[model samples]
Target: MWEAPEAPPRLTVSALTAQIRRQLEGEFREVIVEGELSNFVAHTSGHWYFTLKDAQSQIRCACWKGTNYRIRFRPRNGQQVVCRGKVTVYAPKGEYQLTVEAMAPVGVGEQQLAFEQLKAKLAAEGLLAPERKRPLPLVPRRIGIVTSPTGAAIQDILNVLRRRNDGVSVLLYPAQVEGAEAAASVAAGIRWFSENPDPDFPVDVLIVGRGGGSAEALWAFNTEEVARAIADSTIPVISAVGHEIDFTIADFVADLRAPTPSAAAEMVTARRADLLAEVGSMASALTKVMHIRLLRERQALETLARHPVFDDTQARLRDALQTCDELTLAVQSAVQNRLRFAGWRLERAGNRLRHYPWRPYLQLHEQRVSELTAKLIAGVQAQAAVAQHRLAQALTRLNTLSPLRVLARGYALVQHPDGRLIRTTEDAVPGQDIVIRLSDGRLLGRVAQVLPEPEAKPDPPPHS
Candidate 1:
């Protein structure tokens, strides 16, 4: 009776869609699908909508920006990619799609392709230029390390330093060397050393790296941010990631590349003992050179001393002494002859003096002196009289031509107070003080007139 009354079961579109969505989402939770990408459209909402198909069929695919951003290379329309995701049914569109969580180029792995792509981009930009790389410090006073504190990298670096007895102090900047945040953490560590360097404990070179790991695990260093951080580092960066064969973008941009963490430590630290040994070697070489130089110089001087010139010195001395004796004898003989001739002249003079008469000569000289004295006295009086006559004539002539003499004859000379002679009335300004000079003295007065002299006319030419 109740079974007879049961009506046909009804299913709403929403309920049917919900059931399908749950089944698809649960069954296809994780899958790997290799297909060719087509109809690739990126929405403004940062969600990629595309269709992935092979020979048999095609299906819709979607990759959000958050997932796509982790992809190393941009996916193209015809690219063959192996995508990993879940199959989910969209309720609104009533469609089934692959929600891509990870994608990789089919031929080359994602990490390798991404590394190559980034390397080419950075190389083109000159960030990987050989000239941009810096030389390591000869003796780094302080060394900064950016790696996991508990990793083998730090232990390796420390062991090398301790073994070498390098005096460089260590500054550890702990950072995650792997995982999702590895790139940001590594970049932040590099930036901290570059931006917040302590002057008192200055760091010379920075070692940024980690121990060996798989390519997937070491992908952080291959990131652009890590490479840029290395490139922009102020201190010299030694990239010591993985092993000698494993290289990353950071290795290209770093100032130097170390094969391993131990090598990186060696690069930034130099043992004092090694430096001292080198210096000692140089000093020994210098001492040897100087000794050789002095020996050569002494030999040269000895050779000069034993020459023939020095050997004949005693003979030269004897010859010089003999010549000096002969010169002395000749000088003595000359002096004796000079003395005899002088003695003969003195004898002749003495004989002549004795023969001359004294009293008669004195009387004659006295008489001559008296006559000459009288004549001299008369000549002196005549010369004096002539000089006096000449003086009187000179004074008379001078007085006749003198302006002062004219002034004495009742004429006055006009002059300015400044001692300028007033040749015309124009020489003095009206109401200005003027000077009048008498024969004996000057006088000052005020000017009352300044009349200019009339220009003189040329005289008529004389009749021919």
Candidate 2:
């Protein structure tokens, strides 16, 4: 009801805009806006002023140096983008503007497309082949870097290398990291470092890349010439381009790929703590090997020391000497016994010689001679007597048993012509010449006068 009274025609242009500015400043403490970028202008004062518009409307935006520094890439016209900022009204112009805190590109990213194209081309050329890659040097004496002289990438690499290993030297081959000739310049730097070897430029490995940038800003790394040069380089290369998510042709052709420049530096050198640990391990292993060898040798020596030849050589010699002594004593004793036996035999022989009597020998000899002479004479006389007696007795027996006696006793002995006495008539043959022996003499006879003696009977037994 009070609004009815025509409030003296409200405020003028300036006053109305000031009221709108106040209202807008309160309403948009923070906001999110999406549109296509246009009229992008970056001032020397480090401020980015641009316009965001669509088919329907447009809004002015500004990013001061402090906030603009956070942007990863430069904003270009025709790029669809999203921004987070606060909407505020300028009281002077009576206009609303956005103070952008952060901004990002919308839709399919442009940098991603460029990265894919470069990667695909390099892969087709066999630059990305696993076989083309070489192993990183185990201990790089010198490391080369190809990057913008003032870029943070070089600083990052230097920092890592210095911190990791102070012994390794770094050679910087400065070149533009962005711009038209950056690719060629970078590729030339790589070739120069590889071909030129001096005490100062004796690079064992090369790190070629820069800090993260948008696709357009990183285009130099995507060139075919750069990839070819990297693939052809004799020095082993490590490609560290952009952030972890970014890829480029140089990365594909390098012998090894690192996600960032810092990582590439780390690969070239070893941490001091890690190297010390490795040295300790090797020393321990060597010590163990030496210990094993020493133990084996000691055992062999002990075994030799315990051998019979080494431990008991003196005892063996002594035993042999004792045996020889015993043998010598036995021989000496045997000789003494033999000498005693011989001396005893000689003494006995001498005693016998001394006791033997010549007189007895002579007496025995004379007695034996006399006895032999007597026995010889007696034997001869006895034999003569016995012979004479035997002859006389034989003469008597002969006379008694002689056939002449028989003949003289009125018996006749008929003898064959051969002078054989015939005892029976059968011994005589008829008409054989014979001799009849008589006591007086023998008479010649002839068997023609046959006279048969009468059969005589056997003698009768004697009567009592």
**TM-score for candidate 1:** 0.45
Tens-digit lDDT string for candidate 1 (1-464): 24667776677999999989999899989999998776667799988988777767889999988988888888765567899999998889899999999988776434456778999999999999999988876556678999999999999999998777444478899999999999999999999999997866578899999998756467799999999999888998999999997788898899988999999877665544464466446445544553454355435433433334422344543443344344334434443444345345434433433332333543454455445444534543453344345434544544455576678888888887777778866566788887898877878778666667688999999999
Cα lDDT of candidate 2 equals: 0.72
TM-score of each: 0.45, 0.43
lDDT leader:
1
Name the runs in model 2 displaced over 4 angstroms. 1-110, 179-181, 194-201, 214-216, 271-280, 296-464
Q: All candidates: CA RMSD in angstroms?
A: 40.3, 46.8
Which regions in candidate 1 have their CA more than 4 angstroms from the true location? 1-106, 270-278, 309-464
Q: Mind sharing the TM-score for model 2?
A: 0.43
Candidate-wise lDDT, in order: 0.74, 0.72
Give the distance in Å from residue 383's predicted Cα in candidate 1 to where it truly belongs: 98
What shift in Å separates residue 281 of candidate 1 from its native position after superposition? 3.3
